[model samples]
Target: MKPFWIYYQKEMLEASRTYKWIWVPAVFLLLGIMQPVSTYYLPEILTMSGEVPPEAAALFTIPSADSVMASTLSQFSTIGLLVLVLAGMNTVAGERATGTAELVLTRTVSTLPMMGAKWAAMMTLMLVSFALGLAGAAYYTHQLIGPLEWGAVASGGLLYAVWLAWIVTLVLPLGAVLRGPAAAFISLGTAAALSLLSGLLPSRFQWSPGRLSSMAAEWMLGAGAGAWAPVIAALLIMLLSIIAAAGLLRRSPLSPQS
Candidate 1:
């Protein structure tokens, strides 16, 4: 237990030194704030370009606050997700690439605690960044769009965070064997495929973690009923990812040089 906290602290310090703690949260906050700001200013923006007719501009209406907040989550779903995956892609892989893992593994009895610490540190960053982003989106939505239900926002944000967690967790095990970029690419590809499959076959993929983004939106809109399946599935997947990462690390603590 003490070792776990030590590893976790090390990971946090590493993140700070790498400037990840700053840029990742900044990106999320920017993405979140931009959604509502852009949506609110769309009519004027289009008019300034002279490409939109007055009648067309008049037809534009601000969406509901809930809808704007949901759109903010969608923003996180794309670029925000990409940023997070890229930031975490090298976590384990870099250590191995630099021979840091070899040193760490020699001092540890099992790789599980180290892996767990890495995952926890990643989650800490994710949660703090997401919360800031969500808060910014909610504030702008309230000021520019309409009032929002704080309860719904909190619940929906948790669901969305869970969705992001599983996808980000993929880099752990993947990085154990693959290069950093390869791990990130495959993690993103897997997320894309799952999202596409879930969209195409809603009934079949009801328990899919990919459905979490939409479920989050629905929950924010006050229509997310019976969404426990995907939430549970996502949590299970994260656990499995950690365990797999530990085993993979135990087997191959250092990455093969190119």
Candidate 2:
């Protein structure tokens, strides 16, 4: 077996033992429950806000209750992708910051394997969290909102997760490049900025991961056909990001103090 495989197993075991591991799935499950429930009730809440004058009410075409729920899920997922950044930001930088990298290096561990192990562990955690969240959301939405076109929702959600994962993959390089949690902070800033900037690009270039981050939730809310291009692009980017992150880790300077 490869050393990185062993290292990956160790990292996962450590993460599982930690208390915070429970929160990742728990919070996502809460979002799943809240999103649909809130969507169903939002119209009533708005109506209770007090009857607008006839003229104002006439101009406002209230969206359907189902649309409201979809919008809530979409919005939540957009912000929630940041959870990836938070989960990964310290994947590597924390080890270096605490001088653990030196200890790991002392064991005859190659740089590539160490980095590879960390990346694998982080990606595994990410994939599991995303799957759990999507499963919960899909189940609750189906139960509460009546029958949905799950094929559309599943494809959209999976694609969006892929895009977000690519965006998160940058955190590994950032963590390797910077010390401490600064990498995570930079990853957050980069994801947010890229999401905003994609809007300015031409539609031809819009299928990139950056655009996916901004519009994924909208697609989940039923943007219709042709959105699959970006979805496919996002998956491609996820693969590319992992390769790029590994290469970057391999090239980072070794600690002289070690």
Candidate 3:
């Protein structure tokens, strides 16, 4: 077997044993369902809460179907992103810490395959989790809101997935250099900074990968039909993260604890 695939299989087996495959997607599914259902029932919920004005229910307006779906992706942006980052934070760093890095490095001729495998496994989990969560959100959106344009939804989901992949990929290189929690913190911080800067200077940073989350929402509204700059930038960043991870692991294949 190819080294990369071999290591990828190991990662998969480990993921199964750890129940990550089950719980991660479960969280995403719950988040996906919560948005539409909550939106659908917001007025009722507020009324039940007994803190609003008597006239508030009349002022409540149900959002459009596409908007609700887009907001579901936004939910993924905050809590979903946090869960995924924490889950993948230890890809390399944990291996190094547990002394697995030394064993794997001793067997392999190069760290590139292991690094590639680690990245590929992460992409697998991210893709599957997001796909499940998006599916759940889409199903609820269609059932509650109305019919949706599958083409735009697919495009938007792809943009958002790539945006997610970019951040998750950071864990690989960061894990090679720092402890697991530190890697997660730095990666999340970088993502937040980019997103904040992009929001503050959109015209100047339209090509930023940070616009991807917004772009995903825009696609749901059929507003980003021709936008491609952010997608390209995200791809470039993903490539860079992969390359950086390989180099960093080559330099320090073992963790401080090991």
Candidate 1 Cα lDDT to native: 0.93
Evaluate all candidate structures by whole-model CA lDDT and list the values in order.
Answer: 0.93, 0.63, 0.88
Q: lDDT by residue for model 2 over 1-258, one digit each (tens)?
A: 487887888788877886336766666666656777666565666556766555554555544434544554454455565565776776676666666766676675356666667667767776676667667766766776676677666666665666666667777667666864677777767766766667766464666566664465655667744556666766675556556655655565443343
**What are the per-residue Cα lDDT tens digits for candidate 3 across 74-187?**
899999999999999988889878887777778877777888888889889989999999999889889987888888889899989989999888888888899999999999
In angstroms, give how far residue 188 of model 3 lies from its true place. Answer: 0.6
Candidate 3 ranges with C-alpha deviation above 4 Å: none
Give the candidates in order of lDDT, highest first: 1, 3, 2
Candidate number that wins on TM-score, 2 or 3: 3
How do the predictions measure up, each by TM-score?
A: 0.98, 0.78, 0.96
Model 3, TM vs. native? 0.96
State the TM-score for model 2: 0.78
In Å, residue 129's CA in model 3 sits off its true spot by: 0.9
Q: Candidate 3 clashing pairs? A: none
